[model samples]
Target: MTLANGGDNIGIYTPSFAIRSAHEIIVIAVVFVVMTALWCFVAHAIVNHPKLGSPIRRCGHRVTPFVLVGLGVLILYQAGSFGLLLGRSGF
Candidate 1:
């Protein structure tokens, strides 16, 4: 967004940038909740229904475990990294 505003600097926080970041965080949270719900639905479908939708069935059969682990790792990484950044940001 700063790029759209013609600001080339990185890591320089303006009020607008902070507002945009807040909005982005909200969006990320909503997406995370939706994805988690979908994952649960797909998992339930795969387990309870033998003839589930093919794409979701394939994903649940093959990718669900790995995706779960990856989600955990990603959450940890993002938390730690953003914490470090906030700590350094003089807040």
Candidate 2:
């Protein structure tokens, strides 16, 4: 059975939207990758800097993994949303 709101069984439908042209998928992927990398870089800097703001470094270390996981989830959700838009539009 399928769970509510999760859409675990949903297939790739193509009858609603077109988030962008086929080329847009590549752009979307690149954007997501770059954003994720940028976030990681900043987070790394925060966790690695010296003296000031360094006390939270440990906390940053503790939360960085979770933060990365959350970012990953967000990226995945965006990807799904994009696909949904394309699928909805019957593209």
Candidate 3:
């Protein structure tokens, strides 16, 4: 996922900078590693944190895992829309 978006963004703007292929590969590798680390952190937080589950039961429909998931979806939607703008603007 990061690769598709990152590669498109990089390929668009890096042409003027004349960046090398190796550098582009390095950037993608770093992005992949960072994204992996973040995934691990979020997964661990949701799985190991008992408080996260407590809110769902204690608060009924007002508080549930879907709320947290929705927040993540919102964030991703913003990122994707921003990326689309960048892609179209070629910046």
Candidate 4:
């Protein structure tokens, strides 16, 4: 079996793989949980802030579409699709 990183498998699959990876999995899980909790807390605080919340609520609808479009363009550029499109168009 090929490893997730694309390395050649060095030995037969065994319980040792799970044992060796358990700690890494646990650490990743803990970090995910902590980050999610922190994000929730920060978002709640921001939404409840007197000075900041109203402006965000008012502008969020107007700004979100542009932000999402920008993010999509960024992703396409990173994936080289923008270059492909430009090349096809003789840019």
- Which candidate number would show the highest lDDT if scored against the true structure? 4
The total of clashing pairs for model 3 equals: 0
Q: Arrange candidates, best lDDT first.
A: 4, 3, 1, 2
Cα TM-score per model: 0.37, 0.36, 0.31, 0.50
Clash pairs, candidate 4, are none
Every model: Cα RMSD to truth: 13.0, 9.5, 8.6, 13.2
Per-residue error at 35 for model 2, in Å?
Answer: 1.9
State in Å the error of residue 63, model 1. Answer: 8.2
What TM-score number comes out for model 2? 0.36
Best by TM-score, which number?
4
| Model 3 lDDT at residue 1 | 47
Per-residue C-alpha lDDT of model 2 across residues 1-91, encoded as one tens digit per residue: 1234253223321221233576866786688689978987986887677864578854657876797567555654544654555676221
lDDT of all the models against the reference?
0.57, 0.55, 0.58, 0.61
Worst 10-residue stretch by lDDT in candidate 1? 8-17
So what's the TM-score on candidate 4?
A: 0.50
- List, residue by residue over 5-87, the lDDT tens digit for candidate 1: 44423323333245456778688668868997898897677767756666665575587669756755555454454455567
Q: Candidate 4: global Cα-lDDT?
A: 0.61
